[model samples]
Structure formats: structure tokens, C-alpha cells
Target: MNYAKDPADYPLAAKDPALFVHQHEGAVSWGAVFAGGVGAAAFALILLTLGTGLGLTSISPWSTGASNAKALGFAAVVWVCVTSILTSGLGGYLAGRLRRRWLAVDADEIHFRDTAHGFLSWAVATLFTAAILTSVVSGVVRTGAQTAATTAAASGSVTMEAMQRGNPAAGMNTWPLGYFVDSLFRMPAGSPPPATAATTGSNETPRAETARIFLNSAATGDPLSPEDTAYLSQLVAQRTGLAPDAAQARVTTTYTRLLQKISAMNTAAKSAADEARKITIGVSLWLFISLLMGAFSASLMATYGGRVRQL
Candidate 1:
């Protein structure tokens, strides 16, 4: 009833008495696999460090002599492929050379075992390197997030005040309604502009109110309501010494320009996102190719090592 207990059920073992005698010994040489894997990982780390140093030397901080990003990326990919082949071949050779040789196993079975050993070694090395990199990346991300949080906490009130007052010097990219609000206060040609400090002090509430109206319109993708338009025009006229009619026209023109700018920003953002997606896909494919190179190199070198062992 038990397959292992009855040797009669195993046709090959029944015919070959020598194979039955050594059947108890396991096929895999775990010690060899582990040694090869650790050696490969260490060698890979050394190669990576060397490559990084070489790459840094090739690049220049000054624009004239510096290698462009695209060129650097291509060089990195080539270096990765080279590193994979060298490291994996070394691992495979060690695994095959050090593995326990079989006395009674068939040639085909021996070949398969050697191949398996090579593959396992490569897998272990890859996993070890990945774990190391993952931990490093996680630590860096945590540190960066903590730094950003601290900076934001310290500057929160100042940033909010600057945004509300439509301060042009307060990082334009951070304030969504800044351009539109500033357009509202633009004076006619040859007219002197208002003093920034005086305007900020006296019209703080009105500036904040106008920014809110612009933000709401932008969010809703709708033009300002008639009441809001009239009120904003009156406020603009009072602030800029313009006629009511001119202020109303300016408001209409500025709101139209704001919508156009928003549409342009959305398009640019989508384009940037699409570009990033393509780059990610390209990098992933290259990584896959590099891994395949490692597997093939390892298997080939392991077969060579096994043949040498027989000699």
C-alpha cells in the first residue's frame, strides 16, 4: 500500500540495485546553494558600488560637460546587464563546482540538478539584494516625509497669510488663484502701481474675498455669478481708481483668461503623467531583460562548471 516501503513499485529501482542503495540521499545540495547565493550577493554589491562611482565620475555638475539624463540612463541599463551576467555566472559556477556529485544518477538527471542549483542560487541572490534595497528606500522615504512635515508645520501660518494677501513673492506655484487675483489689480499703461505694503495692509480682507471668489469659480468650472461679478467690479474700481464700466470689462476679461490658464495647466499635467507612465514601463521592461540575462548566464555557467567537474 505504501509506495516508498515497497521497492517493487519503483520499476527503475527494482532493475538497478545500485540506485536503490543510494536512493535515500537527497538530490539538492543546500549548503552549496546557500554559499553560492551569499557570494553572489556580496559580489553584486561590490560591482554596484564600483559602477556608481564610475558613473558619478562620468557626470559633471556644470551643464557644458555633463552627460545628459538619457545618456546616463542608457549607461546604467548596460551596466546592470553586465553586473547581472558576471555575478550570476560566478554564483552558478560555485554552486555546480561545490555540489555533491552523484554516483548512480543518470546523466540527464545530473544535468537537471545542476541547472536547478544554478537557478536557485540566482533566485536567492536576487531576493537578498531586493530586500536590502527595499529597506534602504523605505528609510529614505520616511526621513523625507518627516522633514517635509516639520517644514510645513513651521511655515503653515506664514504661507496661509501670503496666499490670502496674494503676495506675488510667496512661491507662485503654491497659490492657485494668485495670477487671477493679481490680474484684477493691474493698472492701465503709464499709471503708477499701488504700493505693495500699503495695499496689503489696507485691503487685506477684500484681497482674501476676491481670491475666494476666483477659487470657487475655478473649482466649479463656472463663470462668476452676476451678483459676484458686480460686487468684484465695484471693489476693483474702488481699489484701482478705474471707472465702473472699465472695471467690469476687466473682470470679464480676467475671468476668461483664468479659465484658459486652468485648461492649459490640466493639459500639461496629463502630459507629464503620461510621460512618467511611459518611463516607468520602459524601466520595468529593462529590469525584466536584465533578470533574464542573469538566469541564462547562471544556467550556462553551471553546465560548464558541471562538465569541468567530470574532467
Candidate 2:
């Protein structure tokens, strides 16, 4: 009879500890983690680039294209969320399925490990993307700063040349003090006004003064005073060689137009600010929600992938 035919002929391996020894290893697999992270980052980058191209195609520099900023912003938000979900899910699934199997581990422990792998993959991918964006932004900012510096230097040289030509008003048009300086030399109501040649040259003194008055009124959120109106009317009459009543009427009409423009500008600015605030809030909320959803999606997909691998 052969030894294999007898039930008690073979010694049990469990009877000797050395005969069937096992060694446990770490559960975390760096190779799988890296692969998952790189995959997620690449997927995200590709999608983002495609989305940017699509956005650029939709916008135009001229008025002919659809220029609805709100719609564009909304679409961008939606795309970002979608990208997060897709890339995160794929990364998590890859991580789970590729991870080394943990033999003899508890089911609960395996589930926790899968979830951890997914979260870690997402975190690594997010950091990698952030690093790339930061590098790109820093490069752009550095280039812009250099260009601006060069432009400012050139402008400064030209300004200095203008100042050296004995023309006090050469660059005064751009200076806030020019308006106040003009006011200091105002002639009394009954006094003869200065010659047109003296006030009108290339100096732009009167124009600067007028602009300053309008700007000040707008900034203060107040209308021009009666005294200022009268003064401006007198100046207009002297400069235009018109009768007092005609000059006064022209001044009133011009001032009314200016006031309307200022009011419209204020309204537009307020509207822009409100729009920006809303967009900021919306983007923030969407980002948070998308990230939360990405986390959940990643973990769930990871577990599914792991289960499939086991099967």
C-alpha cells in the first residue's frame, strides 16, 4: 500500500511551526500610490487645457462674440467640478486595483486601507497640480514685472526731457497739483480775464483744471457748488468770446452732461463690484462642494475597484 493511501501517514505541517512559517509586510504600496497620483494629475491637466481652449474659442476680443462674463464663469465652475470627479474617480480606482492584496486581513481593515489609498492619491495629485500652477503664475508675473519696469523707465526719460524744456505745464496735465495751481491764479470777478494766448497754449492748464473739478465732485459724491459753476461760466465766457448768458447756458449744459456721465460710471462700477462678489462666492462654494464630492467618489470607486480585483 502506498503511503498516500493511509490517512495518518503524512505529518501535519501545523504540527511544526518552522514547516509553514509566514511573514507579514506593510500594506502601503508606494508604487501604486505614485502611479495613481501621476495618472490623476495628467488627466486633470489634459482636461483643463481642453476646457481653456473651449473657453477661448467662445470669447472674442471684439463686440461680435458672446461676451457674457457670468455665463462663462458658470461654465468654468461646472467644468472644474466635472473634471475633479472624473480624474479623482479614475485615480482612486487605479490605486485600489493596483495595490498589493493583503492576505488574511480583516475585511474592515481592507476597506479602510482602500479608502486611505484613494484619499492619498487625490491629495498627491492636488499638490502636484498646485505646484505646476504656481510655477506658471510666478513665471508670468516675473515677465510682466520686467516688461512694466522697462516701459516705466522709458516713460520717465521722456517725462524728464519734457520737464527740462522750461515749460512748467509740460507734464502738469498728469499731476494732481496742476488743478490747484490753476485755481491760485484765478482773476477776480470784475477783473479782465487773461489773454486767450496765455491760457490756451500747449499747457492744457484749463483742461486739467476742468478735469480735476469733475473728478473731485465725482469722488466726493456731490454736485459742483454754485460758486464753482459761476466761476467756470465766467472762464468759459472769456475763453469763447461769448456773451455772459450764452456762456452760462453752455456751462450749465456741459456740466449737466458731465454729471450724467459720472453717475453712469458710478452705477457701472457698483454693478461690476456686485458681479465680482457674487462670482467669488459662487466659485468658493462650488470648489468646496466639488472637493467633497470628489473625496466621496474616490473612496467609493476605490472600494469597487478593489472588490473587482478580488473577484
Candidate 3:
């Protein structure tokens, strides 16, 4: 009756020596890992979508919208961290609780296996989320590129038709090289200004040349030369039918205004870049911290879940 105490007297136990040997199945449970991973990814995606909706609600196209970019970025970072903690904790708990029990295993090994399951679940969930996001972003970018290309082709065809109909200025407004061509055929100050299409061939060339000059000045951080200023003034006088002194004053005023605009644009660009850099750095740091917290939470929760399951 008591086989442990009387194995020698038991006929079946005496006939089979292999029956006493203990066999260990595999340590890792892929099923539990996958289940937890899927749950975590789904939960994270739902939370992120909700956060996006909330964020969008706070923003508006009108001037009255909450447009503080830095504040929005900070809130996004915080939300992501919170999502990670909650999702990872839940996933780890499920993994540990759902995993099949190991017979005749030491307490230390059980703890190690529980922690490993939690970590693996977190890794799988993170990878799944990243893959989904990458695919979505790639699809959006591809669609946008195709739409832009089609629109550009259509606009180009329309511009060519306008040029054929003798409207040279139709596309010149968007051309950066038009300014240089305009300067090549500058009219003398005393010449009669062309008032109509019949009198003036096309003002596109002159306008283009002016744009090139301004672009060059902006790029090189230099003012127009004295000779260029004089020549431009003469061109203005002929084109606008103004006195020489009046044309010169107008040119000077225009140059001053352009310089002010360029300065303001440069200042705004630098400010934006600085703000973006700060946001990027802050987000990266917070993300790293959040991931660490997630890992800790998941491992701790898994051990607790495993203990509860044993009970």
C-alpha cells in the first residue's frame, strides 16, 4: 500500500527502474507569452487612440485654439508613460497567472521564470506596436506623395497653357529664378515705361531678377551693392514713370522693409528650432524612464500573479 516506504516489495516498481526518474518539460511557455503580448498591444493602441482624440479636441484651426506646442508635447509624453505602465502591468500579470505550473521546481527557478515571462511579454508587445505604427505611417506617406505628384503635374500643365496664351506672369510668381532674367533687360531711367502688353513685352524677366537679388542678399547676409542699388533705382524710375529722386527713395525704403522681414523670419526660425530640440530631448528622457518603470512594474506584478495563481 505504501509504495514509497516499500518499493522493494512492490512488484511494478521493482520491474520498472525508469518510473522513478523525473522529467522536466520546457521552461518557456510561448502560449502565455503571446497571449499577454497581444493583450498589452491592444490595450496600448486603444489608450493611444483615445489620447489622440483628446489632444485633437484641445487644438483648433482658429486663432483661439490652444496652440502651445511645448505643452502638448509634454502631455503626450506623460500619457505615453502612463499607458505603458498600465498595459505592461496587466500583460505581465496575465502571463504569470495563465502559465502552466511547473512540478518539482525550486522556488528560485519559479521566480526567475515568472520574471522572464513578464519581460518577454513586454518585448513582444513593444515590437508589435512599433511594427503596426511603422506600417501605418508608411502608408500615409505614400498616399500623400502620390497626391502631391498628381497635383503638381496638373498645375504644371495649366501653367504651360497660360504661358502659351501669352500670360508669362502666370507661373512667375512661384519661380525663384525669374528675378535674374528681369535684370538682364533693364530699361534706362529716361525711357518711357511699358504700360500694357503691347508696349511692355513681359515684366516677368525684371521681377525674376529682383527676386534673385533679394534671395542672394538673404543667403549671404549682405546688402545690395551701391551700383546695384543705383541700377535698380533707374529701372524703377523707368517702369513706374517716377522722378529719379523719388525712385531712389522708393528703392531704399523697399530694401529696408525687406531686410526687416528677413530678420524677423530668421529669428522665428531659430526660436522654433530651439523649442523643437528641447521637446525632443525631454520626450526621449521621459520615454527611457517610462520604459524602465514599465519593466519593473511588469516583473513585480508577474511574481505577485504567480503567487496568487499557486494559491
Candidate 4:
């Protein structure tokens, strides 16, 4: 046997980890991995802020000034991919270059270790960035909600009075429901002023009752029962000074319209929810793709950095 031949060429039973631990147990440079990860996370934050500024400048609240949403969305996807590549590539290079060179390891093993270091760096960076972003979004949402609550509380009484003035039958009902309820007692043009019996003092009880009926119908998705229809029609006739038959017809029309409005509202809500689901799915898929690109970039760049360091 030649004395100069490599020892690695002769396979050793010592390579079996189940039997014995290897000597190169401290091969990983965790310090370097952490440094690279933190650097990458900082770089990602900078890129994200830049992207946000660019996005804000590119669109407007006014319809004519705003960029097309689909175009903006596509641009955002592209930016994410570019940001991931740059940040991960930099992190991977740093991780590979900062590590202490391994001695006596086979080339394949060195390559594998370098690749692992890069992947680990990328993973750490991803976790750090996610944590930062989550904290920021949570803070923003919390602040916005608190601000809105404060504003609403401050103007509650004034807003309530304005709404009541617009819809006298509203009482304590919400604005939308109040609007529909007010329609029930509207008198024909040129009709005599509503009788003194229909004055605010006398109208409150029936208005409240009508509001309750509408609310219950909306909640149950059921039309008014016959007893309710007749009772409500009688109330309308007495208040509006309309003929009994005309009041009954108006009751039928108003109830039918209310049901139609409720059905339309339900449809709109479902449509909006479906749209939101689709947007979320698209974002998730694009994010996955971006992350995959980051991993590939990191691994590839690490290999290059490792070769440069070895040289």
C-alpha cells in the first residue's frame, strides 16, 4: 500500500454514528449563522419599507388617480421575490464566508455543510422577519381600533341626534333599519298633516314596535306573519291618514321591498367574503413561491461563498 494515499479512501467502521461519535462534533459555526440571519432580517425590513413607500406613491384614493389593483398586486408579488432573493443571498454569503474552514473533511461533506449553514441562516432570517412583521401589524390594528372606538365614543350623542333628526321613526334603531322603518309611515303628497294622535309622543310606541318587527324578520329570514301584517297595516293607516285598503297595499309593498333589500345585502356579503378568500389564497401561494426562491438563492450563494473562502 502506498503511504501517501488518502485515508478517506479506506472506509472506516468509525463512520457509523450508532457505534461512536465523530471527532468533528463542533463543525457548525452558530455564531456566523446568527449574524447572517440578523443581517438578512434587517435588510428585508428596509426593502419592505421601500416597497411600501413605492406602493403608496403609485396609487391614490380617487378613482381616476388610482393604479389598477391587479397591476399593483402583480407588482407586489414581483417585489417580494426580488426582496427575498437579495436578502437571502446576502445572508447566505455572510454565513458561508464567516464560518471557520473545516480541515480534513471531504469536498462533498464541506459542500453539504456549507449548504446547510446557508439554509439555516435563511430559516432564522425568515423567523425573525415574521416575528417583526407580526408585531408591527398587531400594533397597527390595535392602535387603529382604539382610535376608532375613542372617536365613536366622543361623538356618540351628537351622531345619535343627527340620525334621529333624519329619521324621526328611528328612535334607538340603527340608521339603515331606521331608514326603512321611516318609509312605512310616509304620507301621500298633499295629504293633511298627520293627526295629533300621530304626534311624536303617540308615535314612539308604534315606531319601536315596527322597528322590532323588522329586526326579527331580518334575523329569522322570515316574512311578517299574517297577524303582524294586519297589525302593522292598521298602525300605518291610523298614522298616515290613508284609506285602509291603501295602507294595506303599502304594507305589502314595504314588506316585499324589505325582504328584497335583505336578500340583496346577503348576496353582497357572500360575494365580498368570496372575494376576500380568493385574495388570501393568491397571497399565500405567492408568498410560498417567494420563500422557495429565497431558499434556492441562499443555498446557491452559499456554495459560491464557500468556494471563495476556501480559495
Candidate 5:
């Protein structure tokens, strides 16, 4: 009611949305919000860059604490929230404080206008920050992958060679999985596959049938069953020149080698990738929460700033 009677004392709107903004006539100033938003975004980039430097340097795959991906993900979310609040709050407050003072508008309307301006500033600042962050991350990832490939090439390591391939081979048999699989099989480079002998395109041969049996038998992580082992041994004896006992021995050796390789691969891959998947999920959830929090934070911060400006 303090400003109820003053409503009619001001000028009227001639256009749908006011284009000629009056410097001293409105509670929201676009120029001031733009300035504050850019400043907040710049400040956020600085903080995030510093945090990234510290973060990457701190964690390592060979170290003990490096394995704690959940903890790292939690910490990252907390940091993101803190940085968002600090940057957005400052920008919103500044937007509210610097906007034009509404001399003829009602106090309630003025407060609402200031809050809206702050919210707008927050939105703009977040977009600016996101652009910078996206560019930086994309650049870093490209550079890292390139560097990794270069280093692998220089070292003459098979793993690095495989990594350099644009599309890696499939796993185990049906397709190539990794360079490591070649090492597992230890077959001569030009030798026809032990399992693909005398095979036409469409129809499978006895050797291929044995391969299918072996692959199916090896599906479970455990070693091949005794029945599968015996069958595979017979297949090997028929295909190769070895005696039945020697064929079984070869099958046992081959299965043992594959089992060892798979076990090692499973441990490392699950260690690296499973945790990253979890981190990705956690970060996504945290980002949603942060966005909602940011909106509320800007509104409240702007309201308080507007009240202080009036006083």
C-alpha cells in the first residue's frame, strides 16, 4: 500500500515490450546484468581451470587413492555446486544492485523486477560458462588422445598401436577385441585360423564347429567344463595331426591361456570403466540438482539485494 497511489503518476507503455529503456525509470537494466553475467562467467572459468589442474595432478591409476572413483565423483559435484553458487550469487546480486531504480513503480513490482533481472543474469552467466567449459574440455580430450597415440607410436608397444586404430577389432574370436588378444593366441601372422580351416563362406566346417563349441563353452568366466573339454579335445585331434591325449593337452593349454587373459582384462576394465560410468551418472544427477538450486539461489539472492538497494 505504500506505493499504491503512485501507480497512475508514471508514463504509460506505448509499445508491447519497452524498447527504449529509461535509465532511471525501471527496476531491470539489461546492460548491468550483461556486464555482471560476463564477469561471473570469467570468474567461474578461472576457478574451474585451477580446480582441473589440481584434480588431474592428484589422481593416478597406479596409486591407491586413485581407485576411489566414487569419492572423486562426489568431490567433483560438491566443487561444482560451490563454484556455481559463488559465481551466480555474486552476478545476481550485482545485477539487482546495478539495475535502474524504479522511482514511480510499486515497491512490490520493483522487487519482482529486480529478482527477475538477477535470474536472467544467472541464466546468461551459466550459458557463458558452459560455452567456455565445453570448448576447453573438447580441446583437452582431443589433445590427450593425440598425445597418447603419439607416445604409443614412439614406444612401439602393441597396446598403443591398437589404441591408435580408429576402430578397434572385436573381442576373443568372432571379432578382434584388442591387440592383446593376438598375444593371447600367439598364432603365426600368416597362419590360417586353427578353427577356420577348409571353410566356405556360408557353410561351416568341422574346425569351425569346434571353434563354436569352444567359444560357447568359454562363455562363462570359469574354466571349460569336463564334457566340453573332452569334446574340444576330440575336435582338435581330428583337425590337427596330434594324438588324442596330445590334442587334449593342447586344448587344456589354450583354454588356460584364454582364461588368464580374460581374468586380467576383466579386472582392469571393470576397474577403469565401471567407476567412470558411475561417476557419469552421479555427475549428471548433481548437475540437475545444481541447475534447480541455481534458479532458487538467484531468485533469493536478487530479492535480498533489491531490498538492500531500496533501503
Candidate 6:
């Protein structure tokens, strides 16, 4: 027995067209759902626009950075919930209101079927809107990636130069290791040289070579060889106009300073990135919860609306 066959052929058909057979009650009612879905989508778009205007009014670029970041995120969440509630509620209610009335069915079945129609309306509208939005988002991301690549190769030189002239206090967030390395090599103005000066007072030969060695060591993270260190001390002496002994001392001190700064910078950057990731996850979780609540509120409201006797 195909269990799904016309009950009229079976022992149960004539008993009551009302009771046992499930012919889907013309219940799908595609036409009504499409209508409701369209209405819902229109409502959703309207709400989205309204939300955007309100959100913009809540933020300003000139305000404190931390405050603005929080405000923008909060405003966005509120708008999302508002859009979901109003649009979904309107769509679901319209679906129930417009569905064809069922014949030969009990009140319970009628109510159940009616509510199902409303839910279907919401589901259909949500899917339609998501599809549209996905295409838009994909386009946006593609453009953003292209722009990022182009700017990275062009205007990025200015930003890189600015960053390299990095503030010892604030801008040090990006590269702690590099910052620390550079810090070790800096010398105070008017300091005596650590090692013997070059034969020419203006020519600091040892210090120049030491700088080359320092750069190599920093780039590769390899400790300087004794020869390299000795060469640097000589250069430091000549550059600072110091005797051999003082130049050697200055060179050693500067080298040690660079190592310490780099280590500290590395740790600070790792910690900051980790904190940002955690904050992002927390916001995402909240958004998910708000979405679910909006859906539930819309569905329950539709169910109630469906029960309203056709005044």
C-alpha cells in the first residue's frame, strides 16, 4: 500500500472527508506566502534604512576613539533587532491574514495550519532577503580586497614611513621586537664615544661597520659575533668622538638596550591582538541571541494574530 494514495479507494474514504485523509489541505497556498513574503521584504528594507539613519546619528568621528567604537557596535545591534522584529512580525501576520480558510477541519487543525502558513512566510522572506544580501556583501568584500591591495602597493609607502618614525610610546604597538632592537642602538646626544676614533675625526669607520652588523643581527635575530661587536665599538667611538675605552662602553650599552626593547614590544602586540579577538567573539554571541529572540517574538505574535476571528 502506498500509504499516500487517495483514501477514497480505501476502507476509510467515505467515513468523513474531514477526519483521516491528509491531502495537505491546499495548505501550501504558495500565492499567499509569496504575497506575505514580498510585504515582509519591503518592511525589512524600510526598517533597515531607518536603522541606518539612526545609527549614523549616534556616532561621530571626532569623539573619543574607544567611546565611538562601543557606541557604533551597540547602535548596530539595536537596529538589527528592531528590523527583525518589525519586519518579521508584519510579514507573518500578513501571511496568516491572507491564507485561504480551510473547510472540514477542526479548530485545532485550522489554527495549527494557519500558524504554519505564517512561519512559512517568514522563512521564505528570510531566505529571499538573505540571498539578496549575500550578493551585496560579496560584492562589497571583493571591492574592499581590491582597494586594499592597490593602496597597499601605493599610498602605503607614506604610512610605512610614518610608522617607521614610530613614536617610542604609542606607535610601538605594531612591532615590539623591531622597536626594541632599534632602541638598543640609539645614543644620547653629546655622549662620548665608546672606542677609539678613526684617524679622521669626521670619519667614524668602526661605528659605520658596527651599524651594518647591528642591522644584520636585528634582521636575522642572530647574535653579533665578537668580531662584529668589536667593529661596532670602534665605529661608536669614532662617531661619538670618544677614546677607545669610552666608545667600547657606549657601543655595548646601546646594543643591550636594543635587545630589551624588542622583547617587550613582541609580548605587548601579542596580548593586544588576543584581547581584540575575545571582544569580537563576545559581540558575535550577543548578536546571535538577539536574532533568536526577534524570531520567537515574531512567530508568537503571528500565532496570536491568526486566532483573531475574521471581524
**Worst window of 10 by summed lDDT in candidate 3:** 157-166
Ranking the candidates on lDDT from highest down gives 1, 4, 3, 2, 5, 6
lDDT for each residue of candidate 1 in 144-234, tens digit (9 for 90 to 100): 9999889876764334334434443342335456667777877777778677785676776676677677666666578889999999999
Spell out the clash pairs found in candidate 1: none
Which parts of model 4 have CA positions greater than 4 angstroms off? 1-25, 60-67, 147-172, 192-198
Candidate 3: regions farther than 4 A off:
1-23, 60-71, 142-200
Candidate 6 off by > 4 Å: 1-24, 60-63, 155-216, 219-223, 238-261, 308-311
lDDT of 3 by residue, 1-311 (tens): 53254434444445664433322357878898888889989999999999998776656566343355645766788888899999988888988898877654567988998999888888888889889999999999999999987987666533322332333344344332233234334454577655677655466555655655555554555777887778877877766666788777776666666566556666887898998898789878998888887787778777877777667
**TM-score-best of 2 and 6:** 2
Candidate 2 CA-lDDT value: 0.68
lDDT of 2 at 8: 30
Tens digits of per-residue lDDT, candidate 4, 24-89, equal 447788987898899899999999999988876666666562246865787799899999999999
lDDT string for model 6 (1-311, tens) is 45445556443445766534444456666776777778888888788878878877878878997898789888887778777777777877777677665544556876776677677777777888889888999999999999987975564232322333433222233344334334444455676554345554444333334445555565444666778767766665545456677766765666666656655555777788998898889778876775565566556655666666333
Q: Which has the better lDDT: candidate 1, or candidate 5?
A: 1
Residue 196: error of model 6 in Å?
Answer: 25
Model 2: lowest-lDDT 10 consecutive positions: 157-166
Estimate the Cα RMSD of every predicted model relative to the unseen true structure: 5.1, 9.3, 7.8, 6.7, 9.3, 7.1
Q: What is the TM-score of each candidate against the true structure?
A: 0.80, 0.68, 0.73, 0.81, 0.61, 0.67
Best by TM-score: 4
1-311: candidate 5 lDDT, tens digit per residue: 34433323344423412422342454458986897688778878877777767667657777676465545656677778877787778878877777765544567887788779778988999898889779988999999999998975575444422322322221222232332233323433465565554543322344344444445544564667889878877765655556788777777877676556656766887887987897678778889888777766776777777778767
* Model 5 segments more than 4 A misplaced: 1-27, 53-63, 66-70, 154-248, 263-274
Cα lDDT listed for each candidate: 0.78, 0.68, 0.70, 0.78, 0.65, 0.63
- Model 3 TM-score on a 0 to 1 scale: 0.73
- Residue pair clashes in candidate 4: none
